[model samples]
Target: MLRFDPKGPRKNDLSSWRPDVVQIWSIGEFRANWATASDTRVGYTAGGAIAFLDVTDGTLLRSSIIESNSAATGGGILCEGSSPHIVGCEIARNGAGFGAGIRSEGGAPLIQDCSIVSNQGVVYSAEGAGGGIASGSGGLVVSRCIIADNYGADTGGGIFLWPESRAHIVQCLITGNDTCWCGTFGSGGGIMCHSDFATITNSTIADNSACISGDGIEISGSPTITNCVVWNRIYVRRGNPRITYTLTKHPRSGEGNIVADPRFRGGGDYRLQALECGGPGISPAIDAGHPGVEDADLSCDWGLGGSRSDMGAFGGDGAGIRCNPCIQVFGIPEMVEYGDVLNPVILATNLGTFDALVAVVTGPIDTTIPLYRGPPIDVAPGDSVVLERELRIVPSIPAGLYRCDVDATLRGEFVSRGVFETILQDD
Candidate 1:
């Protein structure tokens, strides 16, 4: 049995490194960074965290565990018949033959609020499967996770569900996963279900790639897809998976289905920030969800008050502590003449649930202009504040565009940032 401390050392501490043993612990966290298991033993070997040898059972909560570069099955965690419940954990950068991050063979596990990223599934016997997670028989339930940057040698870059596996994936962002092995013969970049039953709902699958087919998802049996935004192709070769009320590039005859870009905040970041602001390049899938669907994810909050459910992984009222602020620049002339007062005003808003103090700065100061600091303004939730500063445009100044920016901080930590563009005209 093993024990952990909440305020203990980092995850890479020597106390948290457990090799191949059936370790048991209470509610605590274990972080494993740059851990290694050099044993070449096969069959559900956990190089990073724990390896359930026989019929062992345990539960883990609020833990960050990982295993790196293993020659066996599970690099991060391996479970045979032990039912382990993992919550709010981060499993990353593990490598194995079967399941790089996690391998569940003979037990049912519940994984929620976890970030499984940058894992790999190498080829040992014949083919590599399940870069992020590989489930053999016992079903699993995953919710509200960020699974990204995983790779597989054969199939199932993000997740591989083998035959007779029953898994339910809800409200997860699956992106930047790939399977490009043996001259592009791999498939199922995001998920590959070669099983009988799999249910995926309220998830976003985008920017995943495979060599031959099924860039987003590939299934051989019937699966249920609801309220999801799949930016790539869903290759179904066998059973007809009833997909409805979702946003995809190819929409069949269904209720409230559309084909449009989800308008992600950035590449690899599948969050719908454009919908919250309602501007150009906004995703049409916002507020276009089925009311009959229920949100089962217990990690993050979504959507706005008194609005319909969102189509993708995020839905409901956009609440909580947000460090992303909205910034706008004002009183900047396109063409400025020499010997004129260059007045620039920057407006910044705090959209989060905390109060922040904002600071503004201008660069490319050619002349010594007298500047004064303004008093700190207290910004509440969903509030905006303006910062005014004056600069004198002298004759011996450079005639180019000047850059202005604002930064917000909470408790002396930088949280949000805004930038402004100003032009200096030639005399």
Candidate 2:
């Protein structure tokens, strides 16, 4: 647990420090606290967690920054003229006027294998945009990431691409994001692209909501979308987008477009169903992608049909139905008080096809609390285990909402990580 309390601009100046790589591997958490006045204006402050300014190249890996608040922009991370490789990190529960998870301007940043979830936009201001990410005048590459459950006040609940920003989104899942405001002001619940140089491929944009229009994608420029599964509406405001080999609810004018239900695996799992595995029915999106592409297993549709790609995030030269254990952690309380003993029952579920060898639970990561680790247990596929532990809250701990992380490890490798908020009160 490393606490970063920035008093002024010179405190978190990474450009002056000039570190080659800023790696945070397996370190429980890194938090930044920079408080501001209530009447602070927008654009006055940025990067509630970190600010990368004028840095040419860097790497940020395997870190967790959560629940930070900014007065203006980039509540989790702010990149200005810096192209850093941010991978396998979690940026969630942060608040800002724009880009609640990240704000990139004038630099080509590569964001890969990260989770940007449950962040809030438009805090301390009336109109905010880009709850997950906001890019402006830069070339951004987002790959194999999960951007979900974010909220934006104005537009682009999942991602907002400004004019002249070239963003290439590939093999990502954008779901359950939302935008507020009604009428012509609000649009693009999944993504709002104002750039003509954007390209989206092999992605799944589903279950997004907007107040007025563009529940899946809103384009004001001529971007190209290919081999995607858009389960909602797509509103075009200005230029026409070249959409091909995609699956949507409405009939689109493309070479390989289909208007049908994707028959996704329910319970928030957006994978296309196959009838060979006792599924309800075969998904039309299975083996319905571009004719030139193929899955990572060198076969499409799991040997059920032709060797074309599937039309979703799980397809296209990536990990498609591999033998890996996908673990999920849950069951943490939301509130606690001082001098209270918490019997937190952490549940770990293996949702993958393979069996997890050994599951180990570690840490609650507080300054005043002693670290705890649970016993190891094996979890089979589609099975769950309850790691029961007792956490004692001392009187010396402060009273505020804090993020407590629980990590599951399998054979010395990280399987999954879960974050929960606990509000400590002075009873």
Candidate 3:
């Protein structure tokens, strides 16, 4: 029950905004045209419920809850020209002409700890998308959220990643959603991730029905679906042979996942029940995952608490081993730019037993150092080993911060890889 008072940002009223403060969105129907008015903008908003075209400065929507809200364009709350921080919010039953639940048509939204469900699009035709949230060229950070049970006419049942949008969905749940196509264009029933750099980590993306293709999840850009459990039928188009080539024939650099029937608990089970509870079997997928997770996130749920590692989030409570190596560079900023050479002594401590040949791979760049045996790289019992290798940065690397990995590949078995990101600098 939100009240969008008949108020407008008129008569030089934009001067009553602070850029550094946290804007509280207690009501909905929120809209802002900050792209046309820059200086008078808020930064963050998170707290109560809201509705309407909530026009304002920039905002950070954190810990806010929006229920049964609506807007002319952004059903619940439209993030058009203003930069907002939408953190810890509950956006449900909202509707937009374009972005049903949460729409970032012009600005970026750093969303976290939110639940987007049961939202719809007013003009939901075939070519539309994002039943939960949609962003174009916007940097989105969606973590620890649940995006489910939403309705989109075209595509993206739980969530959608369209062109030029960069998103990192970590520790999230995308399940039991529907994508119904009432018009002509239909794709990515569960999630249509095309032409974007997205990372799906430690998440459950299961039981999503799509009207077009990409039942559970689909990716076209440099997408890495690691430590995730994806279940749903791979859709096939009527006359498009491109779907087959885009999924199976794409040379991808990602692994450690389950494509089998992760038989969940029940037909209505969005919780992703384990195999013992009618889920994925004891295949090689168990205990097989990309070892690039943080130490704190290691204690996540692994469903049945089995040994080794399941190929998704929920690492079970028994996950005690932290694989990623800790780098201590005694040099410039605790971080470095994407392309900056360094002669620091690299250390590859063997947290595991036996012997290991640690490889110091390059930055976020695709080039790998190699698979070779170091000077008896061994840490007996409970100890650590250090290697003094001169590291060099590549110029073709990404601009922002970058990560360097240290891994062990014994006889090409692919043991573990520890990752560390470098600080990014501007030219």
Model 2, 146-167: lDDT tens per residue? 9999988789999998977767
* Each model's total of backbone clashes: 8, 0, 51
Tens-place lDDT digits, model 1, residues 1-427: 1212222233334365343332334334444432233321232245455454332233444455553545357767766654555656778887777788888776556566789999988786776888998888654666668889999888999999887666667678899999878865688999998865566767899989999889899988866676889998999878767677788977655777888877776745566755345535666776677774323232324553235667777862111113245544334444567876644444444534223534354545632222223334444454333334556767876777766555555455665655655577665
Tell me each candidate's RMSD, in Å, in order.
Answer: 21.7, 19.2, 12.8
Q: What is the lDDT of residue 3 in candidate 1?
A: 17
Model 1 lDDT, full chain set: 0.64
How does each model score on lDDT?
A: 0.64, 0.68, 0.50
The TM-score obtained by model 3 is: 0.58
lDDT of 3: 0.50
Runs in model 2 lying further than 4 Å from the true structure = 1-27, 35-43, 123-126, 182-184, 298-306, 319-427
Candidate achieving higher TM-score, 1 or 2 = 2
Task: Estimate, for each residue in 104-161, the C-alpha lDDT of model 3 and write its tens digit.
Answer: 5433344556788887654533334677777654445565678888766777766777
Task: Find the candidate with the highest TM-score and give its number.
Answer: 2
